[model samples]
Target: MRLVQVAQHADDLERAAAFYSALLGSEPTAVFDPPGLLFFDLGGVRLLLDRNAPTAVHYLYVDDLAAAIERIGDRAEVIGPPHRIFTHEDSTLGPAGHDEWQAFVRDSEGNTVGLVSFRAVA
Candidate 1:
């Protein structure tokens, strides 16, 4: 089956909505008042933000490596900046290989979220 949606908990609906909007480059299109839930359109997927006691780890894969890092707002904690890692190396030919960018960030509840981007190079 295809992956559809992912959710994360939040204590404050407004704060969570703002954080997620800035980080993911999307805004909440709908909200349920009874449960106090906020939904965001994550590309073709959906992200549910529910008002819970605490948050959880949410991992997102993005194509724009540089833009994602820059979009992370001040309130969100940056565990690491976007950096490239060599997966395979051609030792005989020198440093030539595919690279991937990985970085982590912690949300309000200390949930560590990871972002990765893979790029092929010669």
Candidate 2:
């Protein structure tokens, strides 16, 4: 079966929306304010931000880890600087011959978010 949705807690929907929009490079797909719910399309997967949901640590794939971090700028706090995490020798979890890089940041509502990317080894 394929994954559908992932929910994360947000104390302030508007602030969360702004931070995510910038990081995702797109506006939210849908937002319901009365019950406090927000959605973003992650290539068909729903990323739900709710007022009452428990906080979750989610990782997002980026084309360029450094570029993504730069785009985030002061919008979020960079808790972990970008660094290489692994070098794939075979196509098991990631592309073979590429290096996996990751970094961490705190979102607007205080959720830890991980940013990941893969780059070919030089």
Candidate 3:
């Protein structure tokens, strides 16, 4: 089965919206203020930001880890700097002969988010 939706805690919807919009490079798909819900379309999966939801750590794939971090400058607190995590020797988990890089940042609503990217071995 494929994944559908993931919810994360947000104390302020508007602040969360601005932070997410910049990091995702797109506006939210939908927003409801009365019940306090914000939605962003992540490759067909729904990313819901709710006032009552528990915080969750979600890892997002980026084309360029450094570029993504730069784009998110000052908006998010860089908890973990960019660094290589692993190398794929086979095509099972990731592309062969590529290194997996990851970085972590804290979102506006205080949720830790992981940013990931793969670069060919040099």
Candidate 4:
């Protein structure tokens, strides 16, 4: 299945926009002033930012989960350390001998963001 768009709500537009911009390292591809929305391009997925949408949880893929978390600075509160959630050799999410790790954090707006990465067996 292909995901076309994902949305998150923000009580404060400016704060949320700045927070996500720095956290994602990218600016919104589109923004609407009246409804107060910001959109980011996430590899073809349109990340919808608004003050009215229901709170949503999204996972972002990163090469180095730990470093990405650290780079988020103190604004993002770490909910959990990176843990092996899926191992191809043990589960069906991927091929054999590969591992998928995930870590959870709460963004400045209190939305849950998941950090995920794939690691080779060493």
lDDT for each candidate structure: 0.73, 0.96, 0.94, 0.84
The reply for model 3, stretches above 4 Å from the true place, is none
Angstrom error at residue 17, model 1: 1.0
lDDT value for model 1: 0.73
Candidate 1 vs candidate 4, lDDT winner: 4
Residues 83-110, candidate 1: write the lDDT tens digits. Answer: 8755546545223475667788876545
- Output the number of the lDDT-best candidate: 2
Candidate 2 residue 15 C-alpha distance from true site, Å: 0.3
lDDT at residue 88 of model 1 (Cα atoms): 44
TM per candidate comes to 0.74, 0.98, 0.96, 0.88
Write model 2 residue lDDT over 13-117, tens digit each, in one string. 999999999999999999999899999999999999999999999999999988898887898999999999999999999999999999999999999999999
Q: What is the C-alpha RMSD of each candidate to the true structure, in Å?
A: 5.2, 0.7, 0.9, 1.9
Q: Extract clashing residue pairs from model 2.
A: none
Per residue, candidate 3 scores C-alpha lDDT tens digits across 1-122 of 99999999999999999999989999999999889999999999999999999999999999988888888778899999999999999999889999999999999999999999999999
Candidate 3 to truth, TM: 0.96
| Ten contiguous residues with the weakest lDDT in model 1 | 87-96
TM-score for candidate 2: 0.98
Q: Per-residue error at 90 for model 2, in Å?
A: 1.1
Off by over 4 Å in 1: 53-55, 85-97
Which stretches in model 4 have alpha-carbon errors above 4 Å? 90-92
Clashes of 3: 0
